[model samples]
Target: MTTRADGRKILVVGVGGLGRAVVEEALDRGAEVSVLVRDPDKLARSVDVRRLAAVTVGDGTDPATLDRAVAGVDVVVSGNGAHKRMAREIARAVKRNGVQKLIWPAGGTNAFADDGVTPAYKLHEGRFPGARDIYLAHQGCIDAIRQVGVNHVIWAPGRMTARGARSRDIEVKVDRSAGMYVSYEDAAWVIVEAAVTDAWDGHLVSAATQTGG
Candidate 1:
């Protein structure tokens, strides 16, 4: 399809299910991919290490590590979970490296105001059981990225059904009518496709499946 990511250098952070998914999807799209993982062995179990053009073994939450990892890559994709500290660090590195775009998940479930920047979750702290921590972390990331003035995208996906769902038939949109449940495989594909295709550069997004879950 002659997507923008063809032969582009893309660096993906986080080595868990989502991180691995982004890596594989970027590869499937013909992007030369590199991964920054804390443990190459652990990553190897999830993805074929040889398929990666380079591997940086370190804590992605560390600025020094990320500073090196972001260098020379055309784009950066992060699926490192929603943690304030990690987000702050990654944002700093991404900003410092001058990477064109930073793509990550907002941990989902946040409804935005008409202004687009204000989230409804902030109005009430106790929206649900144990929601504060997660919402705060997601906001922390949004704040960090904004403070650093980096071009980025923060998306949210509802409940993940299959972390290993086959990587195809994925869709990214706002129609929650399809329901919130998502497959990690498809969710990962959304991030990679966005990065490679250079779409959704500075917005928050909600995800759905191609064929209703």
Candidate 2:
């Protein structure tokens, strides 16, 4: 498949926290943005949700709802949390729709050992017993999406602190060294970049930066 650098018809499933940020970023890039959210009112509270090209409210796990949410979109992004079952369903539906391009969020523990990811992040994973499992579930969703024939790029951000300095100029890694951490704001920036960047496809990207906040 040939790659292009145009803004896209993007449906971002999940509209809470990070998901909402992804939708806003897509809109900022001049993309036709739509979102699938569980609560219409909750989403409407966000300044941008009401202004999106389209918005659908329902459980993203249901095929019928996913069909409605995903129809006619070029890409689907599952920014929902690991515990959110709809994350898997959204991935599957995107593939079933034949829109193979997808970008999803992951945990820092999913990084490849040699991907320039920080050693501290990997150490954090190993230090906690279920850290690997927490990250593995995110990978499992990526695997399921791939099995369904979707081209996916997964993103993981290091420990995010709410410092209120939301800036996008942050560094990301596919490999890490040590002493790396990212802010939630920076993580969202990386996710938006992966969603819109021509270079991001069929890859799992992680971010740990020094400049955010």
Candidate 3:
């Protein structure tokens, strides 16, 4: 599939497992990629940081750092965990900088299920105490993105494995009916594809690997 990321300036916040996968895929697709990280040395040790277009060191919540990172970017892909404050800050920066696209990883619970109730959300409510707060916070982040009026895609990959080979076949659903778990690599592929494509723009997609693939 043609991602249309060639020569595009893409900013990735948080270079952890999923973030690293995103960076690699974005680079593979020929995007001019930059990363914003708190620990430049740690990221340097993991990947060939020298290949990146730029690497700015600072906290994601820092407005000045975000401003610097977001400048002149075509799209922003943030895999900075579930911190509402960080999401808010990134959304603000994207809007303030007039970036056109934002791709965020909102958990499976955030995607509405076919039965009209998100299964993970019900699980959090029924079993995990205080987990609802996290869900609500993620919702707040989604709200911020929507309120900003930028074209966005919220990727909801429910349960993800830390390491695995990338799958050639994957499934993506607008509803929460996709598979339960996907490899980090596969999730990253979906995210990068979504970032550069308009198929899922202004929508939330649930992505997972196909079984027995």
Candidate 4:
């Protein structure tokens, strides 16, 4: 893990809350960051313009739109949501453009089986019917990416709070635990790290705080 200021070209597709954090981290890491946003005025007012290399304003789900956003990009880290099929188009464009590195968000539930805690997940599942829907959509995105055979990383983080401390000493697991949780900022950092690292190619990594560290 060399967190260097290499100024690599990176495209982040969504400039909202979570996406904003990703864009900030990418800029903090000295990458040439571009964003695909639906509203440029909002983004310009919201984001630090000095760090933005370019902005493609459109719905990221469209193949042509994604193609334009990803053109000449080395790596693409997406914060797009379940509604717009952003993951699907990102995968397709990554394949089309011969860009190997792609990182997108998935759900912690889908990464782990019901192991009896489906009850708790189901509690939230009931409150929001779309919880399960969103998870399923992420699963579909995972399947699509795997089938497409692109170099990718899918991040699934457990129950999260806002920013805590930044530590690379985080837990990564394929199975869910009742005790597992992560900070939102830490999760975003993990996604950025895994996206840039050569060691995590084609791997799905879950983020959690280091226990008893």
Candidate 5:
């Protein structure tokens, strides 16, 4: 079944790789889309800014900027990661604006189900030694979101690949222990799908592609 987002207002924060994908998927699903980007020029270079409902230029950590961005929006999709301060600011804006639905990707190391370490965390630790502090900082963002008391979904994806097409065989698991590889496209699809629908509302979902695609 095709999920439609027609007439819904969505605000996408941080138009990076993941953010860009979310915007595209949401647009494809017929949603009215807007973006909160620090660098409007950079976002324009990558995406057709004219297709967006609105584009607000400011840092995600700024309350004033977030307040403006979250105004009159139905759902807020956060594409930011590893920045606890930014996440806290977004949560505050969500509460202030009374936006009910929020969809955020978990920090690569943060586990939504249990406190145990995950393969994705070990992968990051091995790739970049002395990065434990960075992981903890991102995890702090997830903690902040949980305390905000908003209807939200945290889509936890493992090592994301940019090399393959999205697979329908992707799995959404409630358990944190799942496969450690998923395509960026698939992860983005799941995030946007959850934003438009209530399938994963108020839950922490771990998603991964079955065949590494």
Candidate 6:
């Protein structure tokens, strides 16, 4: 069950916590990692911008830029969880390039069988400002993938926390574990794993940090 990204070419979209982790993990595993980001300068502040194999600076939502970026890479992993609007474009690029898989971690707080159409998704909007918009966009991303018939692995982690390290201590469950928390690093490891495998293909995954790890 040890699938690695060694020698593979991957395009990771986003520079958020999870995105950064995914890029770093892919690099460590010997994959040629390219990133699609709005601001290339900001990458140095979050992750080592130098270690990346290629850096495409542009708007990922733009079909032209996205399609070009996806054309050369073997797989695409979108860790830009909030840029829910970019999923459809990414899926289009993947389809055009003949790529079979697109990996993304979406709906962290609303990771459930219902696919975030629950009351909890609504509840977060009040608990946190602009939560509703983010959640809605995420749902749209999911729907777009389905509509486009793109083969993808969408992860809905119970709750992603800023804490913890890349110990590879990940546990995926069938359904929501309401209290489960996925660390950014651990989530990155699994996301990179998804880049090269069909184990979780065409499914919505629920992953979190192993409680006892």
True-structure RMSD, every candidate: 3.4, 3.9, 2.2, 3.9, 3.0, 3.4
Q: What is the lDDT of candidate 4?
A: 0.72
Local accuracy of candidate 3 as per-residue lDDT tens digits, 112-144: 767757545665566767557766767778887
Q: What is the per-residue lDDT of model 1 for residues 1-213, given as tens digits with 9 covering 90 to 100?
A: 325458888898886767777787788888999989888888888888888899998998888889888898888888775776777788788878878888877755453534555554444446555556666777777887788788887767766765555534555554122235567777766777678654566766666665533
lDDT of 1: 0.72
Model 4 C-alpha lDDT per residue in residues 132-185, reported as the tens digit of each score: 776777678888777777888877665666564455576665434223477666
lDDT of each: 0.72, 0.69, 0.82, 0.72, 0.79, 0.74
Candidate 6: the clashing residue pairs are none
Residue 15 of model 4: what lDDT? 74
Residue ranges of candidate 5 with Cα displaced over 4 Å: 112-135, 211-213
The TM-score that candidate 2 achieves is 0.83
Each prediction's TM-score versus the true structure: 0.83, 0.83, 0.90, 0.80, 0.86, 0.82
In angstroms, how far off is 24's CA in candidate 5? 0.4
Give lDDT tens digits, candidate 2, residues 1-213.
212324578888887667766676667667788988888888888745556888888887898999988889887877675743556677678877887477877677766566444433356655677776776776677667667666777776556664455554565665342233666666666666766665667776777656535
lDDT of 6 by residue, 1-213 (tens): 557778899898877788888888889888999998988778878888778888887887898888767877888988776464587788888888887788866675445534544533554556678666656767778888778777888877656666646544567753342334678777777777778777778766667676442
Give the winner by lDDT. 3
Summarize candidate 5's per-residue lDDT along 20-137 as a digit string, tens digits.
8888888988999999999998998888998999999998899999999999999999988767787777888898899978787774455433445453465567677844665576
What is the lDDT, from 0 to 100, of the residue 70 in candidate 3? 93
Model 5: lowest-lDDT 10 consecutive positions? 111-120
The TM-score, computed over Cα atoms with residue i paired to residue i, of candidate 3 is 0.90
- Give the clash total for candidate 3: 0
